[model samples]
Target: MAEQTFDVHVEREFDAPIERVWAAWTTPDDLRAWWGPTGFSCPRAEVDIREGGSIFVTMRAPDEWGGGEYHSVWEITELDEPVLLRYIYRFTDADRNVITPAESGVPAEGIPDEAHHEVLLTAVGDGRTRLEMTEHGYTNEQTRDMSRSGLDQCLDKMAEVVSAQPR
Candidate 1:
């Protein structure tokens, strides 16, 4: 069988320059204001913003997914100011336990130390920036399907976040 692949790319023109766009991502306070899907607010924000830094955030929506929802903690593996932010993001439970692949029924041995996720930000000049996000690594077709769908929602949320930012 062929190796399964999972990738997602999202792009948009922001009314702000690359510097501001970069700030929106690196600064915890700024990021809290506009991160994740629309209407899902972040009540807590923690970010190291460097190579191997840690980022933990809680996404809260009044009536989203039947109630507030949370995304697993993400570890920053590579950070290049105003350009790249790469990390492994895992989906977890409230207790912070890595949900097992058996639980998801995808033969995942729990979220691995490395999961496929990376963000690329490029300055397109003229005060506009293009953001491309790619999620990699899915050994199975089923897992790839799930990753594709989820990433669509994530990009939609990202569009909202970028649009909401001040120029």
Candidate 2:
């Protein structure tokens, strides 16, 4: 069967340099600080920055959100330092066991088990960076919408973290 596809795209401009923005994405500490939505917290993050590298993170929801940990992994497919990063992302259990969309509470009728995400960063001048992030293969419109909103919240947190850095 041909692969099904849908895309969620977001673009944001930051007042920091491209390198700083790249660091915010590539660095484990920075990722842990802002990788989840406003009410979620990332308590653990492990990253290997290279093509074929793996990134693992645990995002924990608050008690009001059911108080559980969501483990996710990213298998890096492409990398261009401070410029572009691409990967395939999927969910796993605490032990790193793969979790299918249906098992993870996502509608599985059309959605794929994994999604492809790409981030492109450009130095738009004046020490500023423009970030273009796209996640493709969402299959379901509602899932895509929810993901976009959560991603937006995460990026907002990232902006707050990066914007507080020393220039």
Quote each prediction's TM-score. Answer: 0.71, 0.93
lDDT of 2 by residue, 66-130 (tens): 88888889989999998999999998887878898677653466556888999999999998899
Off by over 4 Å in 2: 1-4, 105-111
Q: List per-prediction Cα lDDT, in the order shown.
A: 0.65, 0.88
Q: Write the per-residue lDDT of candidate 1 for residues 42-131, one digit (tens) a residue.
A: 776677788878677666765845555564667788888888888887655555566654443334632243575777788888877887
Instruction: Tell me the deviation in Å of residue 21 in model 2.
Output: 0.8
- Scored by TM-score, the top model is 2
| Residue 60, model 1: Cα distance from true site in angstroms | 2.8
Runs off by more than 4 Å, candidate 1:
1-3, 61-64, 93-97, 101-114, 138-167
Candidate 1 to truth, TM: 0.71
Report per-prediction Cα RMSD to one decimal: 4.0, 1.8
